[model samples]
Every structure is written in C-alpha cells, then in structure tokens.
Target: MAAYRVPHRPEVEARARRQTQIARWVGLALIWLLVGVLIFLGERAIPDQHLPWTPLSVVDPIGAATKAKAARTGEDVAACRGVLAKGGLTYVLAEDSANGFCSVRDAIQITGGMAPLLPADAAMTCKQALAVAIWERQIVQPAAFEAFGHAVVGIEHYGAYSCRRIYGQQAGPPSEHASANALDVAGFRLANGEVVWVKSDWDDPGLRGRFLRQVREGACRVFITTLSPDYNAAHADHLHLDMGGKPLCA
Candidate 1:
C-alpha cells in the first residue's frame, strides 16, 4: 500500500547545526580582538608625574643658628660658592641642619672670605669663631692629609637638613640638622690618593679611630656638639658637626 511519509532531512538539520557553531566561534574571535586593541590604546594614552619633597625645621640653637646664618648671609650654612671656587666645588656641603638633635660647629680657619667660623653674613647668635678654626686644622686638613698623604682633595656629604626627631631620643626639640645647623660628612679624599670614608673606615679601630679622633678633636675646637660613627649607628656613615654656642664631642 502506498502511504504518505514525513520527509526526514537529517543532513540538512546537521548542516544547520554546524553553521551555528561556526558563527559563534567567529563572533568570539572578533570580540577578543576588539578587547586587545582597547587595552593597548588605554596603556599608551596615560601620562606620568613626579612627587615633591618637604623641607625640614630647626631643632636646637645650632639649627636655629644655621637658618639664621643662611638668612643673615643670604646663603646656607653649608654654602660653598666661595670655598668651591678654591676647591673646584659649587656645593661642598649638601644638607645643613636637623630638627630634633643637637649639633655643633668645628673650630678652625684658613682663608679670610671663607673662615672656619660661620659665614660672616650668617644670622646666628653664636659668637664663637674657634669652631671654624678647629674644622680647618683638625677635620678638614688632617683627614685629607692622612688619607692621601697630602692635603684632602675633597669632602663628600650626605645632607644637613632633616625635620625629624633625634635617632634615639623620644623628643627633645627638633634636630639641629632640621635647622641647617648640622653638617653630615661621609668621606674625604686626600691628594696622595687615599680615601677616608665614614662607612668604610669609621670602624677600622686604628686608621678609622685616628681619623675619627682627629675630626672629633677638631670638632671640640669648633662645634658645640659632635657625633661620629663611634657615637652610634645613626652617625656611622658620617661625621655630624654642629657649631652654635659651646662645644661637645662624641
């Protein structure tokens, strides 16, 4: 018997399913490409900028004196324009003060315009001129001479100004460094080609001791307070020199 039968187009149905699958993969690939392009452009369209640093404040009389000196001379306590001319440096001293620690200047003098004493135009109340004298005779000359077998070629420094508390003390005042009243020296090179760095030679116990002693002895003659690696780790990398009123050494 002849009977009407439903058409079974299985191949057609399978083909349709395959086309749907292909379309989905193509759509996904396009979406991924667009996402990658957007990411690349976003990264290139942005700009960068730098942050600013803050200034330090005065801690003790020495620091106050440094700022005062800077104000008075219209130059910083570590100003080296005049000294630099003689030694070939524009800024021999970097930082000149701290906020919570005490400091003292060295005593000693050499040239007139650049006497060991505070610069003539410094706005400090310190009346002692011997600090510069000590610095010249002991710290500056001896370090350079001993390390090099001749005179010192140059002085390397960390900084002088820092508006913070003393390394150990909880709170006294600000450090003299904060006021630009302190000078932190790192090392010195002698004309004979020797180097006296605080970080390297501060603990040799002999040469380092000799250098520290010389500088400390020099500091006694100049600044009111002197701190060195022998004093503590805080000063292990440099000689802290502060000259404002009296004198003390560590």
Candidate 2:
C-alpha cells in the first residue's frame, strides 16, 4: 500500500517559486499604492497647517507642521517676508547692516497689527518677525484671554539686536541677538492695562503665572529655542526665545 507521489521536477519547482515571488511583489505594490491613496485623501481632509508638504501660511493655526514650516523660513528671506505680508502683519524691511561677526540682513521692523512689540524701533530678521507674529496671534493672545479673560495689548521686550557673543562672552558663538534673530520678552501688557512680568509673575500661583508659563510652553512649540526662568539665572528675568541654534526648551 505505497502512497502515490508526484515526481519532483526542478523546473516545475523553480517555476512555482518564481510565481510565488511575483505574487509577493504584486501584493506589496498594491499595498503601497493603497497607502499612497489613503495619504492623498487624508491630506485633502486635513488642514494645510497640519501637513508638512503644504506651503506654510503664517495665518494658519498652529499645528504639528508649524514649527517645521517656520524653521524653513529662516533659509529664505523673501519667503519669510511673504508669509508676514500674507498674514497681514505690518512690517517694514530694515536697512541691511553689518558689524564684524554680527550682520542684520533681510531684517524687518514690525510696526503694527497684533500686539505692539515694545521698543518701537526694534528690528529682527524676517524669520524672527514671522515667528513673533504667529506666536502673538496663535499663542500669546489666546493664552492671555484664556487665563485672565483679557487680550494682550503689547509685548514688552528687552531688545532684538545686539553685536555680542552668547551671554556677552568674548569667545564662543554669537548670540541670536547678534543677527536680530532673538527676543528677550520681559513681560506682557494686557488690554485691562495690567502687566504680567516674567520676573515677578513667573512664580505666582495665580493667573499671571499660569499665563506666563503657558506662553513659554507655546513658544517652545514655534521658536527653535525657549529659555525661561527655569533655564538659568541669566534668563530668570525674561523668556529668551530665538530661532537660532538647536532646539531647546527649558
């Protein structure tokens, strides 16, 4: 009672193997195609701000892609200015200037719209200005209202441009201020005429402290760097926000 068996043919086995391989390839191709179609459809359903591939608009609500999109503006001055204009930010291009390692090019002095940046003449790179606009509209104002039920009227800043190294050191890399790429926010003025100082209100257990911390957290989302009182003594009095160097939040 020997069982019947088919003779093993190397050619037939090889053909079967090739067919299996082909089937696998077809399956993978179909899977990839389906994935791509889903992504395309999803992009249409989602907001442009959330999609990394879409052109960035400063007016767009802050989303997962905002920081990445904002970062790209640093590379293109015209594009950054365009974003500011499209967002309805009133700004004038600053005269280009250079001083040794410090140079201000493609910089702008934002004059109106949103909260007024203190020190009426302060100027910063177009990219930094764009970040400030987005931050004020999307983060600062909203957080202010949510916390104190009052909108922010003005942003009090230490300054924007300075020809100096990091912490004014004689050596090492230049600070973002050297190129007007940073702002030291000292406090905020509310529509109610009350002011919230990072130096004083940061430790309060009330709305002011919450608002300040919330804005700082949100700044970390848009700016490449955010140093608060928690960072070190140098930043204890103001929130140091910048678009230079690596991403850091403290």
Candidate 3:
C-alpha cells in the first residue's frame, strides 16, 4: 500500500480552489442580502416619524415616550402620549403631587384636542389618561362622525383626580379618584356647538343615546371599570371610567 500512492493532478487542485472561492463569495452575498433586508424593515417600522401599525398607529416618532414612561413605570401613560401625538393632539406634562393621603402620580393635564375645557381642567394619572385618550379616538370620534357629521370639539366632565372617598359609600374604602385613577365624563360638545349631556341623552332612544352607550361599552376595552347611568343613581349624570381592581362594565 505504501508503494501505490499517486501524485494529485494540478488541474484538480485548481478546480477545487475555484469552487472554494465561489462558495465564499456566495456566503458573503447572502450575508449582505440579509443586512439589506433588515435595514429596509427598520425603516418601514416608522415612516416619516409615524407608526401606521395597529395599536401603535397613534405613536409618532417611535419609541419617543418609551424611556419617559419607563422612568415613571407607567406603560399606559406612555401609550397615551403616543396616541395623542399621532392624533396631533397636544398636551403638557403636569407636575406630580404627593399630599398626605392623596397623590397624582405620572399625571398630565391635557391641553388640546377633544373636550379641552368643558366643566374644568383635570389632572389625571397615566392609566386614566390613556383610558380617556383611547376612548376618545376609537369610540367618540367615530361615533361623532356617524351621528352629527362633525367631529367632537370639546368634552365636559365631572373631574379627575379628586382627593375624596367613594361617593355614596360614607365609610370604608377610598375612591379611585383619590389617586387620579378615575374620571367622570358628563357630556361632549360637538363641532356645531351642540352639547350632549349624559343626564339627558342617556335615556334618549335616538342617535345621542346610542352613541353614549356605544362609547360606554367601548371604554370597557381600555378602562378596567366603566359605569353609566344604568349602573346606579350616583352615576346617572356621567360616565365613570377608571383603571383599578377587577374588570367591570355597567
């Protein structure tokens, strides 16, 4: 066996080298192609500083509020900001307050868009703010369009971030409003200056009543609690929305 060894051909070695070179080039091309694909997808994720994707469609300048919300540990607040920005709604971040048993954490005072100044200016927690923003965009705006052929211009409300106990319950537990986690919406002003009050419209069998009920039901998607005139006497004049405890829709 030792004496039978044969020398390799020069052409065979040359052919092998050429094949190896081609394989290497092919691998490099594939890597470059993948890199190009990734860059394209990254660009598409946010086009012209806007997110046109579901849920995130309302966020302009993607990841804009990610760090800010993370700092306050308010995922809902951050999301609301994105929605507001995307919708071209402007707002100002308000000062947070901690006063004895009452505090408004991660609060913001909405400055523009939707019910800007109805009854009063209210401070809201991140969760409450997000719930209201979503309710406005997904429910109120669309319903308003269908009913009045005009957009909603303002909102009336009982208030948000009240430092008080639950209404009607004289004793035990504090209300969600104690921490700015709830808001009471009284009515909405249309683009035509028509005001729809919950007290009057909640009982109507027309579009106004139907729109109110539609929004109340839609609020259940973002708010953990939604109460309407049908709930009880105390809530007969407004829609009570909150984000705390168990999920409830009345």
lDDT of each candidate versus the true structure? 0.50, 0.90, 0.73
Clashes of 2: 0
Name the 10 consecutive residues with the lowest summed lDDT in model 3.
64-73
Name model 2 segments beyond 4 Å from true.
1-25
Question: Whose TM-score is higher: candidate 2's or candidate 3's?
Answer: 2
lDDT of 1 by residue, 70-95 (tens): 22322333332332233321122222
Model 2: lowest-lDDT 10 consecutive positions = 73-82
Backbone clashes in model 2, listed as residue pairs: none
Judging by TM-score against the true structure, name the best candidate. Answer: 2
For all predicted structures, in order, the TM-scores are: 0.45, 0.88, 0.67
lDDT of 3 by residue, 118-188 (tens): 65468877556655765686678888899879888888898887777788365757788888888899998
Residue 227, model 1, lDDT: 82
| Candidate 3 wrongly placed segments (more than 4 Å) | 1-73, 76-83, 168-170
Better model by TM-score, 1 or 2? 2
Q: Indicate which candidate wins on lDDT.
A: 2
